[model samples]
Target chain A: MLNVLWPIFIIISIIYAILSGNIENVNKSIFDSVDNAVKFSINLLGMTCLWSGLMEIAVNTNIIRFLNKVLKPIMKKLFPDLEPENKASKDITMNIIANILGLGNAATPLGLKAIEELQKENNHKETLSDNMIMLILLNTASLQIIPTTVLSLRNSLQSDNPTEIIFPVWVATICAALAGITITKILIKKGM
Target chain B: MKIINYVSIVSMPILIFIILMNGVKERKNVFDIFLKGAVEGIEIVFKILPTLVGLFFAIGFLRNSGILDFIINIISPIINIFHVPKEIIPLALIRPISGSASLAIATDIMQQNGVDSFVGKLASVIMGSTETTIYTIAVYSSCVKIKNIRFVLFAALIADIVGMISAIIICNIIFV
Candidate 1:
């Protein structure tokens, strides 16, 4: 369904772009902004390394263990299949930590590692287990707390209060996560 | 400037050592892993370059062609009916196309409306919270080999709506 729909959506978007005379503007924007994009990517890569290093420090200093201790009950509820000592649990913790700090570029590798760990624990190879589905859903709706990248962009744009939206961001993301998890649970119950 | 440069240079080796110690491997594998990571990074850049170019062009054309305004106008009545601020419409519309572009728009709104303003904060929150719609759908569907994701697509769209509404309400309640 998506294979057909994706091509159609892309085609429609292209047509829309052409009809709206956006193609020319888009071409200009692309060329004009490529330099900035490259610069931004470099800066982002540096930031990612900084944060990942901080995460590594946290792990080495046993802060992650403390976090895991606090988060254990919640993790149990969210991922019932995985035991507390499992590598999947640790990877999930790391992924969620990276995500909450708005280090999505860093989180991708952790997420992949988590999934691989989960796959190893799975006994059946036929279909995705319940835990895998839940993990994907949760990951898709991971709640960001700091929104570091957005704040950086705001700061770069010279906004007066770059961090002013932090509370709202937290609230909105928490709500989305709750709603997504609820819907996912219902869907799973209904065998969808 | 001299002090800063000296500090950075002095700290560089320590930083590398710390990162190396985080893994179980010795100094040799650190270099190897860093090289591997660099290669992968370049590969990702090459893969996404075309899509980024195309997306930028499309967004640029839409803005210049006045089509964005037209669409915004058409939706203005509904927007007003919902008491949604005019500034948020573009962010909502563009969120599907590109997250970074939507952030740029959101920053502009924040600049114009005052970052503490309800609409500005809401736009920021929305920008921060949601994923790039088309990108997420494309990546996930391709991964699962699911050809027919009409239901999934609709669910994601509905999720975006919910995300938007929740963002506005939460921001208004908390900030305003």
Candidate 2:
């Protein structure tokens, strides 16, 4: 997917920049984007290391097992084919937990780890499995409970009631998640 | 707001404490295990560095080139037929593409529309509900070296569209 989309973005951007006489901005954006990407990754490293370490502890201590037990009912619905003891299940559970808590920084590392674990079980090395696609959909739907960053941004902008959108956010997120799961299931059944 | 603040602040520390305590109870060499995991984390980050650079470069061009505004302008008339606020078009379009881009647009919406206004609240809901679909998919798939993500992008985009429409409808009913 990114294979085609990435080049299209650059091509369209160049054409548009040329038409609008903003080629210089596009040139600067190229260099700046690379620099920003590195800086952003560096910013992520600290939290990623911390959560990765903590998750390791959780795994070693059977805490993940406890969590898996706790989340089993819901997990079963989302991942019926997955075995209870699979390492991917543990990583997926932790990723979902981090996302729900609005710890996006933590979620990325955990999610990457989840993908790595899922890859180990994949029969086709290049093609994504149903489970993998579902996991990505779950992340994209983003069922965050608090949306702390949005609230903070609103607060900084001096909103009179910064947290008032929480209910609406929850409603939208649940709908998105359901829609994602339903569509993916339909497509998978149709052999897409 | 205060309750939200309190929860966000306390959740992290409490979670960390619980995990460490559990490790101790299990008689694990916590520091050694942590070091091992951190090393893996570093490797994962390194693996993703190229993907981020590529994705972000595309996003930067698409953002700074005024293409988003152009697209928004083209769509605004059609979207206005549905009574969706014009200000949210940029946000809804950008939300699934780039997190930072959407954040900037959302902040701009709130600044211009008043943070307590209908458009501002709707933007907030949209931001909270949707993820950076392209960025997340790229990073995760690339890390695993998965080239074919059949229907994953399609389904994720549907979710994003549903989330944005839900935000608009829910806000209309509640805010009105």
Q: Which prediction has the highest lDDT against the true structure?
A: 2
- Per residue, candidate 2 scores C-alpha lDDT tens digits across A47-112 of 778877777787788778787789999889888899877888988998898888788877888888
Per-residue C-alpha lDDT of model 2 across residues B49-154, encoded as one tens digit per residue: 8888888899899988888678889999999999999999989888888887789889999999999999999999999989999888888888888888888999
The TM-scores, one per candidate, come to 0.71, 0.96
Residue B147: error of model 1 in Å?
4.8
**Candidate 1 per-residue C-alpha lDDT over A1-192 given as tens digits, one digit per residue, 9 for 90 to 100:** 433543554455556768766667556655665655565456546545554444444444445576789889888888876888887788788777667655676665456556657767656543455566556555566466556667666667666677767667766777777776677667667776
* 10 residues in a row with least lDDT, candidate 2 chain B: B1-10
What does the i-RMS of model 1 come to? 6.4
Please name the candidate that would achieve the greatest TM-score relative to the true structure: 2
Prediction RMSDs, each to the true structure: 6.3, 1.5
- Candidate 1 chain B has its poorest 10 consecutive residues by lDDT at B141-150
Off by over 4 Å in 2: none
Looking at candidate 1 chain A, the ten consecutive residues that score lowest on lDDT are A53-62
